[model samples]
Target: MPFLTAAVVLVGALGLVNLLLTLGLTRRMRQYGHLLDGLEPAERGASTRPVGSDVSPFTATAVDGTVVGLDWFREPTLVGFFSPGCSACKDVLPGFVAAAATKRALAVVEKGPEPADEYVEPLAKVATVLVDDQAHEAITAFAVRAFPAVCAVDSQGVITETGVQVARPSAAVPA
Candidate 1:
């Protein structure tokens, strides 16, 4: 009878230890989720180049080998930085394309080993689509660290708005 009592106590202790480990793992997972949420651009802490900063001068060849330079920003330009694999970039692409209706938007798509014809095609219709295969010069010039980011650049070359995604200007705001 004493041996039986001791065995029962040992089993209960093991079960308590298991419950404590599970609770700890659950708490850690919740903390990790919060960390991920904070990394999202919509979160206040997401990093971006400062507004009102001038784009660094850069020259890059477009997919068609057309030379593009700082002159691209001489007009009020809406520049989008995207990656082929980023789901967030794909989600915001149609809005980016529609905003390009004024002929003032440009998309710099980070090239990968796989062909991105489908993603590039739609933007090509309304915007100058630049496939960045080599150095990612444009991405460096704009200080873009995240995919699906947009900067509203003024005619004078100053960035007016910078965010994770382009906000189509309200009709009241100048196009």
Candidate 2:
């Protein structure tokens, strides 16, 4: 029947249109992905001080009342910037604490509305903990642009490694 033929043609035409539309959307997604890949870290607002950069001069008191500054890095040290307001910071805390336990580490926590006890307690066990308020000095000194920023600084006060996650130092092999 002609009606059946017409219906078949209509269905085939709709299928062809759907295929074309899907292809167009996929092509657009690829184009967007390429565009995103071309963006810089600074452009994306995730840039942090690069490795080999010197830490800016700063002094602050840790929760234990010890004065901390660049001079405090007399040995290779792991430094982490965290915030109570950031969920990512919470996720990173456990690992940071574990890693800090084995190395000389400093943990800077940005003050939030709630008490800092949640962050300070565990961090203090493994690191010299500093709880900083607005425009946190330690955060500025390290030029961190994102929460949970971490770095390894050498004795000379130059950052040697910087990232969201740094490789944990391996334990020394006993002779």
Can you list the residue pairs that collide in candidate 2? none
RMSD of 2: 6.1
* Residue 165 CA displacement from its true place in model 1, Å: 2.0
lDDT by residue (73-165, candidate 2, tens digit) is 888888888877778778878888888888888888887766678888999998998886522878888888888787888888888777775
Report the C-alpha lDDT of model 1 over 15-127, residue by residue, as the tens digit. Answer: 99999999999999998886676563553412346787888888887666667677867677887777877888888787777777764777788885556676678877777
Residue 130's C-alpha lDDT in candidate 1? 79
lDDT minimum window of 10 residues, candidate 1: 39-48
Top-lDDT candidate index: 2
TM-score, prediction 1: 0.69
Q: Candidate 2: worst 10 consecutive residues by lDDT?
A: 166-175
- Number of backbone-clashing residue pairs for each candidate, in the order shown: 0, 0
Q: Quantify all predictions' global Cα lDDT against the true fold.
A: 0.73, 0.79
